[model samples]
Target: MTDLRELQFYATPEHPCSYLPRRQAKTLFVDPSAELDQCNYSLLSDLGFRRSGPHIYRPHCEGCSACISARIPVNLFRPNRGQRRVLRRNQDLEMRISEPHFSEELYQLYRRYITARHADGDMYPPSPEQFDSFLIRSNHHTRFYQLHHHERLVAVAVMDQLDQGLSAIYTFFEPEMAHRSLGQYAILRQIEITREHNHPFLYLGYWIRGCQKMAYKTNYRPIQLLINGQWVHCGD
Candidate 1:
């Protein structure tokens, strides 16, 4: 086990907060050179750290702590009525878990998703290089959950299988299928996958209160939030 104290971390200067407008945010990142094996990655996750590409980091903003690390205790999670509807809505789609790899098909879908849904976000002008760096660059534990309807691809959820649980790295779906609520369906399916694998939790990255984009995370009942270095159960 790598000692937490032995690992080095660096904090970035305050930048514009991605989730909140007009707010500055700082991030504490694990040393880029650190060898982040599954054991230490799990440890860092327990301490509220999240992985992005090859980097592991957690929010370190001063005076503002809106980004709360959220996870669903799989054994304790019970899908609400709305979530059940999402499951039913996406029942026609088949989910396949596969090793991470790059394909032009996937990239094209990602490009359309970003162009339609996130034109105002940093990932607006999605390119092959950006897609490769953000999602295709994979570690040993990375997996891609591909959702399809017969022959048509609809969604892809990028996940990392950790020692303790699975972390939802990123998910993008067909923007035109808004009626299907594919984003929520992806998370719902991931929770089931975690339970099937006998994992304890499914990390959902950071959930910021009052951020409409993040509010969907709280719908998963009995979520645990890392606060003050401890995990606290909410909405039991």
Candidate 2:
């Protein structure tokens, strides 16, 4: 049996629940490292684990069903016309996938993304140290991609490489590019990248129904959900 103690957990201060009407939510996660390979990470992910702050987390509540693991099956994905448009619109943008790096320009874009789209949200105005703590720490094979426009940083996404596919941990983009639908663009790009790499799926952390912010995930037809310890196809 695996030693559960090897996993670490963190506590969150009491705050309003992001999911339910009156639910209090917290996360249990593991500090990720480049050493943690896809096979091991899959074990944790199957148990509802999500990475944030160098940690992989799963909902740990006495009673809760709000958080559910969701992923996109690249083999089954069929981009809708609108999704195709979003991809086409940003074709000029260049994607650079490399080891995670820190930059003032990227930080500035991150700050703008948080302030404009998530000002009151949990991840607001994180200091450079905090940012480094979150992005720089990883277990297993980890990588991040930055979207550049004319050599300017416009967006960034952090991903964990598991044996089967790529897991998208988090992403942020310039608020002024909202019309470009940067959030959706990021996911679509990940799928394309996964396909290029000949990977099977793209793990999109979690998709909480009823949350407007998360509802967009449904638009990506041909998704799969980890239900009752299995992945079931979510038809288009």
Candidate 3:
């Protein structure tokens, strides 16, 4: 519904791929100060661009196209036996939608998670400043969905409400609770929330084949991959 040409985009210099080590990656991003209007942002998402804090961007590699944008058609989703267990086990979790802001509890959990799991990635050694800039919402459309257990905050999922669907931007939880598979639970809960709002798709961001970090995404069966500007069912 918005004119694509009315906005400007800048592609970043090639950097090492975060998902695929041997390959380099580039990104195309919009000028947040100039062209980050809600209309333009919505269109960018339809074109497969995702947001990290304030920057709305998508992979723009020249030779490699491993980073494929993926989404779940909520109406078509069927949780497997394992996923169903994840739901029933997490039935006691309390979910709340709130404004995007800084919280000591969330920050502590984020630090612990990154320190234990993603120390080798770009966001290694998380700090308060990095936490604020990477997870905080700048354009003002992001909503923080917090999951609590027995009144103790356990997980937080950042979601962006888009024109076509709800974008599951990022999530972090208590690293010690790894047995509960909090990451998978977060997605399932988001899907239920999407269904309640009548959203057709639940954007799951980019899924790179051969990346163990991204392998879990495939478990959400019947997902659609955006390839060559067309969406094809992964199940097909």
Candidate 4:
């Protein structure tokens, strides 16, 4: 058996929960520059963390079922009719997955995406420093995928590589490119990447049954839920 490891997670005092209505929220994060191996990721994923930059975090709360870890079986995955259309729509775009780096254009598009999609939201305008600290500071198995539409940055996705799967940290896209359904396209691309790499799963973090912001992830069929510390297939 692989030996367990330890890491520190820091968080705020308390704040209103984003996913669960009327509930408080808090986050405890470890330094992205810290050592994190495949075994560490396996343990953390089991603990309910998705991934962000190099940090692993789950919803730490007094009481809440609003957050659950989710993943897609890459081997059995298939692009539905709609997903195919999204792929077709983004055929002209180019994707590059590499070490995380902040760019002005990427930041500008991210700001627009936040303002247009979540203006009234808590993380409306993430400062440049915050964005850097959130994504580029990681020293572990973290990567950023940038999608370019004919040399113009259109979308970006931060992810973590684990022994069994890939975890999508967060994604942002140009608001004007909404018609392309970049979000779904990104997830599909990740599935393809995961499959090519022989990874069995694509961790999507959570699937809140009623949250519109999170429900889109569930559209990917043949997902597995980590319930009671066991992987439960939603279809079978």
- Choose 1 or 4, whichever is better by lDDT: 1
Ranking by lDDT: 1, 3, 4, 2
Point out where model 4 deviates above 4 Å: 1-14, 26-35
Return the lDDT, model 3, position 192: 89
User: Which digits, one per residue and each the tens of the lDDT, describe model 2 over residues 1-236?
Assistant: 23555655566555567666677776655643334556767777766677775566677654677667888888888888998899889888998888877778877887788788886667776667767778876655778789988898788988888767888988989889788888888999899888888889888877888887788777887888878778888877
Worst 10 residues of 1 by lDDT: 131-140
Give the per-residue lDDT of model 4 (tens digit) for 113-166: 888998777776777876887778765678889999888889998888788878
Model 1 residue 120 distance off true place after TM-score fit, in angstroms: 0.9
lDDT of each: 0.90, 0.77, 0.87, 0.79
Off by over 4 Å in 3: none
What would the per-residue lDDT of candidate 3 be over residues 1-236, giving only the tens digit for each residue?
A: 33677667899998888888788889998766664666676667767888998888888999888888889999899999999999998999999899888988889989998998899999998999998999885684789999999889889999988767789989999889987899999999999889998989999998998999988887898899988988898772
Off by over 4 Å in 1: none
Candidate 3, number of clashes: 0
User: What's the distance in Å from true for residue 42, model 3?
Assistant: 2.4
**Model 1 alpha-carbon miss at residue 144, Å:** 0.5
**Quality of model 2 by C-alpha lDDT:** 0.77
lDDT tens digits by residue: candidate 1, 123-192: 8799998988888776549999999999888999999988999999999999999999999999999999
